[model samples]
Each structure stands twice: as C-alpha cells, then as structure tokens.
Target chain A: MSARAETLPATGLRLPRLGLPSLDALGAWTLALIWIAPLVFAAWAAFHSPRDALAFDITAPWTLDNFAAAWVAAPWLRYFFNTMMLVTTILAGQLVLCTLAGYAFARFAFPGREVLFYLVLLQLFILPEVLIVENYVIVSRLGLFDTILGIGAPYMASAFGIFLLRQAFKQVPKELEEAARVEGCGWLGVLWRVYIPAAKPVYLAYALVSVATHWNNFLWPLVVTNSTTTRPLTVGLSLFAAPESGVNIAVISAATLMSIAPLLVAFLIFQRQFLQAFLRAGIR
Target chain B: MSDTDSLDRRRMALYGWMLLAPALILLTTFAFLPTVTTVWQSLFSRGTARRPAEFIGAENYQYLFDDPVFWQVATNNLIYAGVTIPVSIVIALGMALWANGHLPGRGFIRAAYFTPTMLPMIAAANLWLFFYTPSIGLIDRIAGLFGIGATNWLGQPETALWAIIIVTIWKEAGFFMIFYLAALQTIPPDLREAAVIEGASRWTYTRRIVLPLLMPTTLFVMINAMINSVKLIDHLFILTKGGPNNASKLLLYWIWETAFSYFDRPTAAALTVMVLAVLGLVAVFQFRGLEKRIHYR
Candidate 1:
C-alpha cells in the first residue's frame, strides 16, 4: 500500500537521478573496503619492517626480511608437503568411496537400501568435529595417531560427497546404462563407462570443496598430529604465531601470507570456478 | 523360475552391499561408532593409577554442571551464535542485494568480500591478532587520531567476545553472500519488473517479492552458520585462547581444553554429547523444515 506514496512523485522537490544508485554503490564499496582491510593490512605488514608496519607509514621502504625470518623459523616446506598429502589423500578416498556408495544408492535395488542411505545421511549431523574425543581415541587405538592418515581418515567417507554424487548419478538417463549393459558389460563396467562420465561436474565441485575444507582444517589435525612431521600449514602457522613463541607481528604476517598464498593464488586465477563450485555445493 | 528370480535378487543385494561396504565401514569407524562410544565414555569416571575406571553414570555430567567455567563457556557460545548467525546473514543479504544489482566495481567488490572465505580461519585469526593487540594495534593507531586511548579489544573480559564476534562476521558474511547471490540469480527477473511496474519502491519490492523467494536460501545458510558456530573455534587459539580468565571461551574450545589440555576425557565426552544433542535438534529441524520448503518452482 505504501507503494502509492513512493510512486506518486507528487512532491514538488525533485531529487537528482544520480542520488540513490550512487548511495548504493557507496555503501557496497564501503563494506567491501572494510571487509578487505585486514587482508590488505596483513600484506602491508608482511612487506614492511615491524615498526613501519605498525605505524601504517605509506612512505615506509618495503623489505623481504620478514619473509626470510619466517621461512627460517619453521619447517614450512614440510608443512606444505604434509598439507598437500593430506588434501590429496582425502580427496582420493572420498572419490572412490562416495562414487561407489553413490552409484549403489542411485541404481541398485536392494534390501535395507533406504536404511543404509539414512545412515549415511546421519554422518552429516554426527560430524567428526563434534565427536573429536572419541575419534582421537579411535585414531590412537588404530595406531594411526600422529599420522596424516589419521587426520584424513574421518573425512574420507563424506556424506555430502555421497549425497551430491547420488543426486548427479540419478539424473543420468537409464538408456545410457542400458546401452552399455547390452554390450555384456557388468555393473562396474556400466558405472565406469556411463555413470562416471555423466557425473564428472559433480565430482569436480565436490573436490574443490573438499580440498578447500581439509586445507583449512585445524583442530582435528592439531589433536592427532603432535610433531612437525605431520602438521599441516594451518597447525604449523598457529604454532609459529603462538604467543609463547614470541614471534614478531611482521614475521607472523609473512608466515601467514606464505601459508595461504597457494590457495589464495589458485582462488584468484580460477575465481569463476571457485565461486561456481561453492554455489554448486551450497545450493545442495 | 521363482527359485532363479530369488537367487538373482540375492546376488543383486550382495553386490549392492559390497559397493556400499567401504563407505559404511569408514562411516561406522569414524562417525556412527564414535557417536555411540562418546556417549558411553561420558558416563565413566576418569581412571588413574590408583583406581580402575568405573561407570559413574551422570557423575561426570554433574561435575560439568557444577563447574562455573562450563556455564560461562556455554553462555559465551550462545552469545557467539546469537550474534554471528543473524549479523552475518543480514550483512550477506545486503551484500548480495548490492553485488547482484547495477553497481560499478562489482567484480572487485565481490572478490574483496570473498577473499576472506578462501583464507584459513587460523590465518584470518592471525591477521586479526595484530588488529586486536593493545596499544600498538590497528584499532589503537586509528583511535589515536580521535584522542581516544588504546583499548584492549581482546585482552579484557568485556570486549574480548565482541572482538571475536566481529572477526567471525567478517569471515562469514562474504561466504554466506555467495549463497544469497546464487539464490538471487535463481530469482526470475520478471518478478522485479512486475513489482516496479506495479509502482512498488525498491524496499517494497525486496520485502514483497524477493525476501520470500530467498527464504529457502536463508534457511540453508542459517543451518550452516549454526553448525559453524559449533565448529569454528580456530580463532580462539590465536586471538584469545579462551583467556583473560575464560571470558571468550566457546563450547568447542572448552571441549578441546577439557580433552587435550586438562586431560579429562570423560568431561570432554560429556561436553561433546551436549554439542551433539544441539546438532541433532538442528538436524531434525533441517530435514523437516528444509525438505518441505525447498521445493521451489
């Protein structure tokens, strides 16, 4: 009903056409700046001397000493290797496990199928994060504690991955599977030939999400891995920046930037794909 | 013929189970079995060299309830969730409306917003650690311009939780905006045209046509944010360590402390059970509420 008052335009005062849209743009840019200021400041601090960094001195001479100091302080290369191994191992496991389980749920007719699917879905709620205490115990009991495998094991059989694949697989035409089966193909062959190709996009989306997630995962890995041998960049960076370590802010910024640089660069380069993958994952 | 059919059915069932076996085993090992064992472990007393562990049903829970730190942490978590979820969602909604609109520098704005989501929470926390440091920090440097003294944002009990809340909002709003943006794209453009043609103001258009359409997305984001409030405690390690006397301590942080730092497994298990109970309630709401409302045309 108030639309009438807004639409009337009956008031004698005429505002500039540029007024409202410019106001909106102003608001957007402000929020964007505030949102990004911390990161920008971190980049600034990483490049400048510690005193100059805190001073916010625009004329300060840029230097690389902080990066050098940070690099020498920790075994960052080993941490990167561990993180890479952890991400790759988890993705590979999720791919194999979710694909098989998803195909079974999508195509197979079996007893207790619904029950099994619900059980898989239950994992969505009973996440490893919440059950950390027992998961730690289980990891220790299985003699995998302090290993990358222990860090990666709980996340490998992801319900979200399975659910996404099942949805993707179910959308494939039955005729395609029938065509493959007519060539005397077994179930495995049909899945390999027909189903996997059809669900490739879903796999890509799930992989992007899984990689980003495990790369940033901290608490479980922190609990499971005690030494530099198994620490991911995240846990490693946390330790490097710990208050007890007494690392200077500038050096911590450098280490922080270096640790996130790979993902950040990948995100910038494949910005479209990253956003699309998040959208694809989020909507489901 | 019937005998052959039954045999074939059995073979198919067996094959299906084999395909599902790997995932089920992992899920059982990690998710299902642990959930049961966490509950079971919570009912026991901590065993020391002098005594073997025995089932002290409800005693650990009693201890948790009696501990004032538990209550403080729980309350802190509630405030954290209560503040972060709606604030981030609202900011995200505003961001989505702007980015999805006819704004200049839209791509740069969107990128600036989303870059935080790509950073690890620990990295974000590290960056903010400098911002929140007393006296020589960013906030103090800026406040100096206004003749205001350096305030200890993360060092004091009063403002420490609020400081953490601000960082959480910054990290999350942009991520949540992606969902809102996706939802906005799916909103048919013709509806906006119709609303404008009907003499509706921009605000009216959003309230009448857009917000209702975005309800499912909002619900989805709300559920994710709720889960995140429970899980996203990485900042506590860097920013506060639940410190200044447990002022900013959250539930998950406390659980980690109880389990790892304090070496009290039973108490930690009890806290985990409580978190699980909260999550379970959310799960039911999501399945029931989301499943029905998500059938958008």
Candidate 2:
C-alpha cells in the first residue's frame, strides 16, 4: 500500500512524505543495533587484553592470548564431545520412539486410542523439568547416576516430536501405503518405504528443534552429571565462568564465545533453514 | 473365516501395543509417574541419619504455608512473570512488524533480532555478567561519562531482580518475534489494500484489522511465554544464584536449593507440587478460556 501510494500519484493533490528515511526502517535498525550490542561487545572484549577490553580502545592490538588462556582453564574439548554425544543420543532416540508411536496413533485402530493420545499430550504441559524432584530419584534408582545416559534418558521420548510426526503421517495418502503393501511389503516394510519417506520434512524440522533444545539444556544435566566426563558445554561454561573461580572478564568472554560458537556458526550459515524450521515446528 | 478374522484383529492389537510400548514406558517413567510420586512423596517426612522415613500427612504442606522464604520466592516469581511476559510480547510484536515490512536491510535486522535466541541462556548470562559488574562494568563506565557514580546492579537487593528481568526480556523477545513474524507473513496482502482504499490510517488498520486477525497467534505465543517464565531459569544459576537474601529467587531455583543444596527432600517435593499446580492452572485456563475465544473468532 505504501509502495502504491508512492508510485501511482493518482490523486492530483500532493501529500507530505512520511519521512526522509522511512520511520519503520529507522526503528528497525535501531532495535537491531541494541539487540546485537552484547554480541559485538563480547567479540571486542574476547580479542583484546583485559586492560584494553576495559578501556574500549579502538586501536588496541588484538591477540589470541585470551583464547589460549580460556582453552587451558577448562577441559572444553571434553565438554564439546559430551554435548555432541548427548544431542545425538537424544535425537536418535526421539526419532525412533516418536515415529513408532506416532505411526501407531495415526494408523492403528485400537481401543482407548483417544484417551491414550490425550495422556501423551499431557507430557507437553508436565515437562520433565517440572518433575525434577522425582525424576532425580528415578534416574538414581535405575543405577544410571552420573552418566551421559542419565542426562539424556528422561527426554528421549519427546511428546512434541510424537505430536508433530502424527500430524505428518496422517497427511500421507492412503494409496501409497496400499501400493507398497501390494508389492509384497509387510507392515514394517511399508512404513520404511512409504510413511517415513513422506514425513521427511517434518522429521528435519523436529530434528533442528530437538538439537537446539538438548544442546542448550543445563539444569537436568547439572543435577545428573557429577564429573567433567559427562558435563555438556552449557554446564561447563557456567562452572568455568563462575565468579568464585576468579577468572578475568576478557578470558571469560572468550570462553563464552567458545561455548556458543558452534550453534552461532551453524545458525549464521543456515539462517533461512533455521528460521523456517522454527516456523514449521512452532505453528502447530 | 471367523477364526481368521479374530486372529487378524488380535494381530493388529499386538502391533499397536508393541509400537506404543517404548514411548509409554518413557512418558510414564519420566512424566506421569513422577508427577504422582511428587505428591505422594510430599506427604512423607525427610528421613535423615537419626530417623527412618515415615508418612506424615499434610506436615510438609503446613510447613510450606508457614515458611517465609517460600512465600517470598513465590512472590518474586509472580513479579518476574508479571513483568517479563507482557513486555517481551509487546517488543516481539514491534520486532515482527518491522521485520515483516518493507524495511532496508531486513535480513540483517531479522537475524540481529534473533541471534540471542540461538545462543544458550548460560552463555547469555556470562556476557551480561560482564555488563552488570560494578565499577568495571560497561554500564557503569557508560554512566560514568555523565558524572553518575557507579551503582551495584547485581549485588544490591533493590536492583538485582530488575537486572535479571532485563536480561530475560532481551533473551526472549527475539524468540517470540519469530512466531509473530510467521503469523505476519500469513496475513493476506489484500486486507491491507482494502483498508488503504477505505482511507484507514496505518494505526487504525493495525488496531482494527491486523490485531484481531492475529489473536490466535497471540494466544499461542502467550502460552509459550508463560511456559518460558518457568523454564528459563538457567540464567539465575549464573547471575545471582537467587542471592542477596533470596531477593531474586524463583520457585524452581528455590526447589533446587531446598532439595540439592539443603537436603530437604520433602519440602522440595511440596514446592514441586506447587509449581505443577500453577502450570496445570495455566494449561486449564488456556484450554477452557482462551481456546473458546479463539474458536469463536
């Protein structure tokens, strides 16, 4: 509408221009600046000496010493490995469990299906975080304490994943399943050939959401894992940057950047995919 | 023929149960059974070196009702929710409008707005911790230019929770903006054209046409924002540890401290039950109240 009003000039009378620069654009740019300032500051402080970082010297010499110090201060490589293992374990578990459950709900004719489905949906509200007290006891009683599996166990069967995949599988054309079955495919073969292939996009969207979530999870892992061998990057970064450790600001910023760098870099590279993934997964 | 039909029916049922077993076991273990156990455990006394575990019905609830710290933490959480939810939603709407419009550098602006959501809450806390540090903190340094003296942002009782609230808003607004942006794109362009032809002012168009159309999305976002108010307490672990006499303590953090830090298991169970009750109320309100409104619209 604004574009049409500007270009056509159909009316003889002229109206005042809204502004020299569009106020909408100006406001957006300002907000963007405020939003990005913390990240920009982190980058600036991480590259310079502590004195230079505090001084905000524009012409100061940049050095890698902060990164070196940060690396030596914590066992970051192990933390990274742990986070990767944790995310992979949770994602793989969720895909298999949710796919099977969703397929059963979407296709099977069973008694009490509606009630059972509602029970599954209840997990969406009663998240594991809310059940932390009893969940801790359950994890320990299973003799999985202080292990990576303990951290990943409670979240392996995701209700959100099951809900999404159920929606996707329901949209699959019935003829395709019958065709696969007619070609001498059994139930498992039909699922592998038809339903799974049809729901690839949903799987991808759910995978992105799940990866980002488990990668950033902190409290449960902090409770379950007692050693550096199992602590993910977020918990490790928190402990490393704790004020009781007496780490300086420059090195702390460097360590913070290291912790978030993988997700940050992945987002920047696949910005469109990341945005679309959220939109797809969230709209339901 | 009848025997074959019955056999097929039994086989189908078996397949269904086999497929559902894994997810049902997990959900029961992690979510459903734990909720029941939390309530059950709250009825028992915390066993220690001196005494065996015994059921003491309503004692924990009575204690929680009388505990001053529990009351204070609950109040703090309410204030935290009251401030963060509305402020973040409004900012997110503004961001979505800008990002969805004919703005210069739209891609960069949208990305800049959303970068915070991509970063972990713990990392965000680490970055902001530098900003809130007294004297040497960037905020104090900037204020120093105007001859204002250094003020303790995180150390003092008065300013600490507000400082945490500011960080929470910063981290969340961008995330909510994505949902708003998605909704904005789904709005038909013809509605704006019709409003323009009718000489509706921009504000009027937005107020009358756009907002009503976005009501469902707003309700959805509101529920998400509510859930986040309870979920995103990771930053507290880094920033304050609910410190300065528990001025910044939230309900979940208090639960953690009670159970893990103090080894008061029954009290923590009671607190957990309270948190669950609050969440359940919100869920019921959303489903019964707001959902009807959305459907009517």
Candidate 3:
C-alpha cells in the first residue's frame, strides 16, 4: 500500500504504461532479498569448507571439510532409516483410517453422527502437543514406548485427513454412487471405482501434506523415543546440532543441510505440485 | 430380490460401523480420551503435592488461581502471541504482495520464504539454534560487523522470549502467505481491473479492494497463528529449553514441566484445561471474524 504514489492514470492499460509504479517493484525486490538471505547463507555454510564459512571475511578459502566433518559427526544413515519407518507407518495408517472414516461420515446415515463429528473436529484445535503428558502415559502403558509404532501411533487417525477426504467424498455426487450400486456393483466396488478415483486429487494433496508434516514432527518422537535407535531425523539432528555442547555454526549448518537434504530434494523435484497442494489445503 | 435387498441394506449399515471402527477408536482413544482425561484427572487429588493421587474436587483448579506461575506463563503467552501473530501476518501479507507482482525469480523467492514453514518445528529449530549461537553464529557475527559484541541469545532470560518470537515468525510467515496468495488469486480480476480503469492508485486498489477480499484469509491465518503461539513448543526443547530462568518458557512448555518434570500431573491437567479454554475463546472469535467476511460466492 505504501509503494504506489505516481502510477495511476485511470485506465487498465496504465499499469503497463507505468511499469509497476517503481515503489512496488522496489518493495518486491527488497522482500525477495530478505526472505532468500538465510537459506542462501545456509547453503553457503553447507557447501563451503569450514575456514571459509567461519572466516569473518566475505571472500575466503572454501573447501569440503564442513560437509565431511558434518557427515562424520554421527550415524545419519540410521536416522534416515528411522525417519522412513516413522513416516511410512503414520501415512499408511492414516490412508486406510481416514478413507474409511471420511467415507462413513460423508455417505452413511447413522445415529449420533453429527455429535461424533463435532467432537472429532475439536481434535484439530487441541493439537496433541497440549495433551502430550496424557499421551505419554498411554504410550508407556501400551508398551509401545521407544518403538517406531509408538512414534507413529497417536497420529494414525488424522482429523485433518478425514476432514479433507470427507469434503472430497461429499462432492462426489450421490447419483453416481447409486447408479453404480444399481448396476450390480457392491458398495466396495462403488467406493474403489467411484469415490476413490473422484477423490484422487484430494488424496494426493493429503498425502503430500501428511508426509511433510509428520516427517518434521518432533515432540511426539522426543516423548516416545529416547535412544538414537528409534529417534527420527529431527531428533537425531537436533542432538548433534544443539548448542548445549557449543556447536560451531559451520559444522552445525552442514549437519542441518544433510538432515533436510531428502525433503529439500523432493521439494525441488515436485515443487509445483507441493506448492499447489498447500494452496489447496484451504487456510488450515 | 426383496429379501436380498433387505439383507444388503442391513449389511451396509453394519459395514459402515465396521469401517469407522479403526479411525473412531483411535481418535476417541488418542484425541478425545485425553481431552476428557485432562478434565477428569484435573479434578482428582494427589494428596499432598508429593503423594500418590486420589480424587479431589477442584483443589487443583483452586491451586492454579493461587499459583504465581500461572499468571507468569499466561503473560508470557500473551507476549509471545502478541509479537508472533501480527509479525507473521504482516510478513505474510508483504510476502504475498511481493510475489503477486511481476518480480524477478518470484517462484524461487517464494520457495525460500516458504521453506522454514515446511519443516516441522523440530528440524527448523535446529537450524535457528545454529544461527543464534553466541560468538560465531550468523546473528551475532552480523551484530559483530556492526561493532556489537556477541551476546548469548537463548542463554539469557532477558532476550530469550524475544528470540523465540523472532524464530517463530521466521518459520511461519511464508506458510501464512500461501493462504494470502490463494486468496489474492481469488479476488476478482475485474475489481483490480475496474479500479485501474478508475485511476485508483496501486496502493489505493490494494488497500480498498485486495485487502478486503483477503480479510477472511487474514482472520483465519491469525487464528491459527494465535493457536500456534500458545503451543508449538517442541522446538523450545532444542532452542531455549524454556530458559536460563524461565524467560522463554511458554504456557504449554510449563504444562509439560509440571506434568513430567515436577510429577504434578494433576496441576498439569488443570493447566491443560485452562489453556484449552483460552484457545477455544480465541478460536471462536477467529472463526466468527472470518465468517463475517467470507465471500462464499
């Protein structure tokens, strides 16, 4: 709002004649600079050698010591394996559970359904973090503590997943499902052949979001797992990067980069689809 | 046909219940059960702040009223939300503006902005901690270049909360902007086009047309931002640990401390209920504000 003072000429064509009113152009330039700086700095620290990274000088000697030192600091391979197991379990369960729950809520006629649905929506507000202590007690009692399942279990029935899929399923049109049923297709067939395909985009979007979110989840894993054996990438990476032991900036950035490398690489490959998914996540 | 149809109808109802079993059970056990347990456990007693628990009516609630830490934590949440919400929303609004224009490399810039929001607080917190480290880290070194001496960010009580607020904004702003970006796209192109036809300045068009169309998104964004302010504290474990002196301690972190650290699970439960109450009220107002502005058409 502050950027426009001289470019309005009372015509739609004026914008082209004016070339973005100068100030807005400058404002855009400045915002881009501020937003991009930290990640660029992280990249510089990650790729450059330690001496170059640590040197107060802007231009200095660069080498591969930072990456090498960062790599040797801990067993990142194990952390990656643990993260994979953790994410796969959570997503796998969410897919099955959310689809069923979503389909039921959307299509079925049942008693107390609205009340049950209302209670379910409340989960979206009272995130698991608020009730972590109670959750800890449950996980401990179940003998799931320190197991990958413990890390993935509480998140298995995602309210967000159910809600998103429900929205998609409700839009699938009742007539189509009825016709399929009349044509001798079973209910399962209608779901698999009709509802599921109709909701594929929502499913794809939900999958992207679920993976991005759970992959980065920390508190649940921290509460459930103690040892590196079960700790996910975030927990393991934090242990190595935390400042309590006085970590150096250069080495820590290298570790941070290595940890996020998979997700970051995935993002680079499916950048457009990922951004579109978030855009469609509908302000949540 | 009639007999089989009756059987099929009956079976479908049974099948619906079967399908809902896993998700309904899991949600009830994990989410709904804990919420109910928080209220139930809060009412029970532990018999002397140091003993095994028993049912005690409202005693924990009464204690919360008397406890000085409750007020302190509430105030800290206010401060955290106060800074984090507006800063994030404004930054997001600004980010959206920047990207909406024909800028150089806008896509790459948007990705850079949105990167931190993509990371779970755990991973992102590690990256920030490295940046905020005392002597050789990025923030201090930049301060050094400006002739300022290195200072401990998370180590001190005075700067700790502010430090957390800054990082929280850094992580969240871009994510909020994605909503704004989507909202911006939906604002009728004709409104802007008509405004330009009327010689409305770019600033004027945005202030009057774009911003209003985006108000619902803003309200929704701020509500989530407020809720995040109250809770998102896993990152606190690695970054501030809630303090050298509880300076950076947030409400939920303190609840965590009370539950596990002090073994005062009853008080923690009471505190959890209080936190939920406040969040509920904020959420109500947030949604109400959004509903008022929502242009469903």
**Docking level for model 1:** medium
- Candidates 1 and 2 compared by lDDT, better number: 1
Instruction: Rank all candidate structures by their lDDT, best first, as comma-separated numbers.
Output: 1, 2, 3
Candidate 3 C-alpha lDDT tens digits along B1-297: 999987876776777788789998998778888888889999988656477678878999998889786777788888999999999999999888777655557677678778787766766776676577788778898899899999998889888888888878888898898888888777666676577668887778878887888877887887789888876787788888888777788889888888777988889999999888887787568545545655553
iRMS values in order, in angstroms? 4.4, 3.8, 3.3
TM-score of chain A of each: 0.93, 0.93, 0.90
Evaluate residue A192 in candidate 3 and report its C-alpha lDDT on the 0 to 100 scale.
Answer: 90
**DockQ of every candidate structure:** 0.53, 0.55, 0.45
- How far residue B80's Cα lies from its native spot in candidate 3, in Å, is 0.7
| Candidate 3 Cα misplacement greater than 4 A, ranges | A1-21, A48-52, B1-13, B45-51, B283-297
Docking class of 3: acceptable
How does each model score on lDDT? 0.90, 0.88, 0.80
Candidate 3 lDDT, tens digit per residue, A1-284? Answer: 42343233222223443444555556766766676566667778766666677664567666668788878888899999999998899999999999999888888766667777766676778788788878888888989989999888888888888888888999998899998988988867898989999999888888888888878887668778898899998888778867665667678777877888788888878988888898876654
Is candidate 1 or 3 superior in DockQ? 1
Query: Which stretches in model 1 have alpha-carbon errors above 4 Å?
Result: A1-21, B1-5, B290-297
Tens-place lDDT digits, model 1, residues B36-141: 9999999999988899789999999999899998899999999999999999999999999888865678889899999999999999999998888888999998
> Which residue pairs come into collision in candidate 1?
none
Candidate 2 lDDT: 0.88
